[model samples]
Target: MKILAPVSSLSEALPLIESGARELYCGLSPAAWGKEHGDNIWLNRRGPGKANLADLEELEDIVTLAHRKETRVFLTMNQPGYVKAFYPDLVSFVRDTLSIGVDALIMADPGLIKRVKEKEPAAVIHVSSLAAVLNSSSIAFFRSLGAQRIIFPRYLDLRVLRKMIEASEGDLEFEAFVLNDGCVFEEGFCHVSHAFGGAFCHNPAWSYKLREISSGGNKVSQVPAGGESFQQNVDEYKRWLWLGIKNFGGFPGPGGYPLGMCGLCALPELQALGIVSLKIVGREASLRKKAAGVKLVRKTLDLLEAGCSESELRERAGELKGVPGLCRSGYMCYYR
Candidate 1:
């Protein structure tokens, strides 16, 4: 399996490639996009400025450098869907990126995918996880639309993924999330906009109440509002969310790697199931965090390649992550 790292700037290219990323993916938002649509409207799924490369020039440079190392770079145009009005500009933007030698387009919207394929017949496209391809039929649908690979959505059951791969026809490539950034919901169905400040799920001020339906057909609190037991459960949920989002309270663990939702223990199974790429999912993270992610995955894959037993690999991965408690708890696991 190949390591696919996220790159957001020209400077991130070489180091990530050297760190064991055979493939790189990044988001791009041209200056004209913001000028025309304003900052609130995102050209891609991620926030504009920090998460994306600002111009094609930098992208071209990064592509050229990556190509020299035989590392492929993919550009993300993977919004769930866009307005019809944006198609003309979106198509043109895709054309420009392809002309500059971007290896492929990682996208979600079927209409946009069809449009791009019609315009650039030879352009390679990977269906983004945002497409939420959940079953064999979904895979076939995308294959018909000319997607060469599928980035499976986060939180899918491994058995389901394996069955889908087994049942599917043709030579479609499959990629799975191996590290970082877990979402609380399926991204394809989420309507809340992250283009503003952040996602609704990440709002810290939010609270939850557990209620039961009484025999009288009225609602009754299962636990008293703000009761100690209820408050403890809510606080525990928040901590898990925090660990998922910031990887142990916004800092690297003792092993110098971010400890977020991980699938390191599943690497052996994923490879056995014909998964072609393992994705590390933070394009907006700092350079150090990105590099550390690559290093951690690289080391883990090395152990797998060297014929470590599944149990041995899991133990090693937990040790490398330096959070055995988190590993044991299974809160940060992607495959458990």
Candidate 2:
């Protein structure tokens, strides 16, 4: 199983490739786009300026360094809304960036796909998780548009993913998340905004704040967001607390440290099934974390290839995870 990782900066390129990242993906927010959309309103799924490389020149340097190590680089254009009005400039940017020697364009927007096809027909398009591809037909739809690979959504279980692979029958390249943060809802379907300037999902303070507000700050929270009554709210709070204690490795605080999600335990199974890539999520993750994640995945893949049992892989993965130990719940796993 090959490891595909998200690169945030030029410095990460060599270290990540050295750490065992054979494939890398990143987002670039040109100066012009940043000026207009500000920081939060990103073209891709992540927040601009924070999760992206701003200068194409620097991106080119990183790409070149990665290529020297035989690592292929993909650029994510996973914007949900890039309207026709933005086409001319958008096409210009894409065309220029493609000229910088990117290996593929990972995206979710059909309009952007169409535009990329029109401008750079030879482009290899990989559908992003934002596309929420749940089955073979959805894979076929993107395949028809020249998408060669599909990063299946986070919600898919092992049963369904295996079914999808069987249904595809060697027609598509399948990538799955191996490690890092996870979400509480379907990424493509969630209407809830994540910070940027609102009551977003990333903010863990919501749990406590909602509890207090639900009770009108009287210490008895009423109608716990989705549930009814103070007890139900209290139960929900306890559940979150329990989840924090179980999931977020070392950073077991209220925020859960990027919401405390992981899929390291699934690596042995995924590798057994011959998964094309195991992705480590975190475009804005720190350099140490980036290298450590890649190293962990690399070590696990090596252990698996050497015929390590699932139980053994699980133990090593927990050691790497470093906190909120064990894979006791499907909620914390990336592909349980």
143-257 in candidate 2: lDDT tens per residue?
A: 7777788988885888888877787744678888877666666777776764453325543334443334435546654444664766566565555433532234334333122
For candidate 2, which ten residues in a row score worst on lDDT? 250-259
Cα error of candidate 2 at position 264, Å: 1.9
Query: In model 1, which residue pairs have backbone atoms overlapping below 3 Å?
Result: none
Residue 67 C-alpha lDDT in model 2 = 84
Superposed by TM-score, candidate 2 places the C-alpha of residue 335 at a distance from the truth, in angstroms, of: 2.1
Worst 10 residues of 1 by lDDT: 196-205
Candidate 1 C-alpha RMSD relative to the actual structure: 2.7
Each candidate: what lDDT?
Answer: 0.90, 0.73
Q: What's the CA error at residue 41 for candidate 2, in Å?
A: 4.9
Tens digit of per-residue lDDT, candidate 1, span 1-336 = 999999999999999999999999999988788899887677789867688998999999999999999999999988888887889888899889999999999999999999989988999999999999999999999999999999999988999998999988898999999999888788888877775556666744478876677868876758765647977888877877877755665588898998889999999999999999999998888888899999999999999999999999999999999997788788898888
Q: Model 2's lDDT to the true fold? A: 0.73
| lDDT of the structure predicted as candidate 1 | 0.90
